[model samples]
Target: MKVTKDIGVWTGTWLLLWSTLAYIDFFGIGGISLDTYFFILSFIVVFITCYLIAKAFYRTPLQKTNIVNYKFIKILFVIVTCIYIPILYKSLVLMTNGNIWEYRAKAFGSNDEASILFGNQNLRILYTIFIEGGVYFIQFAFLSLYLLTGKKSYLFKGFVLIFVMSIVMLGRSPIYYYALLVIFTIIYRSNGKLSLKVPILASILACVLFFLSAYRAGGEITLSYFIDKYIVGYHLYGFSLFEKSGGANSFFATSSWFGQATLGSFSYLLLYPFSKILSINFLYFNSQEYLLKNSFIVLNNGDEANAFYTIFYDMYQDFSWGAPLIYGSIFGIVYGIVYKKAMLRKDLNSFMLMLFFLNVTFGMIFRNPLATNGFVGFFFYFLLYILFNKIMKKRLHV
Candidate 1:
């Protein structure tokens, strides 16, 4: 496949647009704060690393025989899905029994728990590990299968696995499924462009179906949530603009803008170690009091903080200046390897690249790795690689 100059331009443009959006989302529009600087620097590092990987894809020659077989990928996916079933079942049990949120709070060392009810230390630890580990492995299997098998059936199966795991572990959030749908459509589309009529009609159908699903799920599907929570709360107040009190909205509060700004910039470097240490200290030593007392801003809903600002702030609280450099370097190296390998194959496709991009955006940049299900990240990348090889072979006429 010949590398088009347009592809390069599109890649560069996407990076620029998303990075800017991310920066604004993280730091607001107050120019370069400590967080902003760290974020930009880390992003640049990751961007360069990914760019090299994409370049390698453009340069590498195609292969004749399959690198891996579809049967193997399918078996792997099945094994992973089976492994997740128990964990999912356990989470369902906990959620249904009304201990899900309580368990999360206690696991995180929240001082709100007056007494320890579940004294099965081993079981508790196992459950924690299972939930975390299961999600990561499930993601890996799903992504790997998608990459290895170009079959849309496998891709849909991957999405279903991810969706089930996410719902079980994280509760019902439509975002994951929506993201999967968008990615799948992008991957399956013959080209990026859609005829005006086709795209519009498809989009309308998607919206209608989304609402129908939500309605069937017993939740009132209102446009207000998207407008308020995701759009204004997340996109507007959460990024680029400040609230009247220089705080985040109810659904998305952060520490001081300065604190968040300082921490967010270097978050790529700070997030991992911070998560590791906090997880240990909170889980083992019962250190919730310190965090709560020292918190710059206490959110009414801590789960929101988990997805929004907790990771960045926690890192800053833990490792100050050293966080960004160490974390950024490690993340950059891993991303570099993935990108390099992908580029070398010359099989990188939009779907594969988009998955990588979203993983970095949602997992690495916006949320804490520890707080998230690592399997989702692993699954997305692996699936992309598998799908890239499968789909590119057909699309590129290799």
Candidate 2:
């Protein structure tokens, strides 16, 4: 793939954006009080290693797959839409009348408790489909098809789904993720040709994000306040935590009693699904305790210092001083190989998988996406793709 389309470049770009802001401490609250020379060195080592490995694998031959049937996709879209509409309707009816942000807050128990989406046990079975499955992936599939087939209907469906989901979910991150996927799809479709619209869309996305955040904060917070508390707060808090603990002070290291009985924070991403499947809470670990305990901040009415602790903090908490080397190297290898297959070979299935993996990569500036129920969502995405591919192959053979 072209350097511009590389996943490592994409990850590095986002990491730098937030990290730079944190380092500058633009609000001058001493965001990062400790020296980060070694931390930064660790990141640099990972970045270079990952990029080189990805480039080296560019020569790998592309894998072949049967073309997906648009007819089947249209039927599948109808089915998924049917499955989700009632859920959205019930959620809207249950939520407060005026506030939009309350939807996400309620669903995930971020700031509030009356979650109409996730709180109900009967309705929780479809959480995976609601989160990263049918809703968002359908939009991605239609958008990709629109680009390839020049089908306006596909484009229209994509936008309609995006609009409804954004309004219903009221999540700024999902919107940003969709925007990133759009940009990536365009770049891949155009064979690495950089479009002028990319910058334009980014500017628009930035504005939308700011306004949404301000609205969520009750419209009393200013842009500077939002950026400082959120955009910059993640790394600032992360670095500060590292400094205070003297390295490796996460619950994993400290909570031996809990760790002996249950999995640690690092295992949360990997073991979450089985926990959900078997109804075994012990198999899964929740990072909310860690995030709340570690990332407290008082700014503009005070909160849990922004939910984004940055991947570095999570790594350091788990691996202490070795976080940089371990996480950086692992991420590098995974991203490098995935970029080689998805972006370079232009495999749509691989691209879809790449997009799913992006929940971790793009979210590195924030907390691990897998910290919550994201691992189950990723599993569903992969499972659905495999099943759909089989159906497509069978149809082609018939």
The best candidate by TM-score is: 2
Give the Cα-based TM-score of candidate 2 against the true structure: 0.75
The weakest ten consecutive residues by lDDT in model 2 span: 255-264
Per-residue lDDT of 1-398 in model 2, one digit per residue for the tens? 34366667777776665556555656454445334535745675786586677668656676654446455456657876776687678666755565655555566553334346667543453464444456656765676575555565765576566655555566566666666777776675666887786787777877877776765665567877777665665445554443344433332444332221122333654566777899876541344336453455554224344445555655554555555666677667776777677654555566665666665666655555655343454456546667877887886789
At residue 101, candidate 1 shows an lDDT of 52
Off by over 4 Å in 2: 1-3, 33-37, 57-59, 69-76, 94-105, 109-114, 117-122, 128-131, 143-156, 203-211, 214-295, 299-304, 372-375
Can you give the lDDT of residue 292 in candidate 2? 55
lDDT of 1 at 357: 41
Residue by residue across 34-102, what tens digits does model 1's lDDT show? 354354455455555555555444343544435443444455566667766775676556656665456
Clash count for candidate 1 is: 24
Question: Candidate 2: deviation at residue 232, Å?
Answer: 5.8
The true-versus-predicted C-alpha distance at residue 356 of model 2, in Å, is 3.1
Question: What ranges in model 1 sit over 4 Å off?
Answer: 1-73, 79-149, 170-221, 231-307, 310-333, 346-358, 370-373, 376-398
Model 1: per-residue Cα lDDT at residue 176? 42
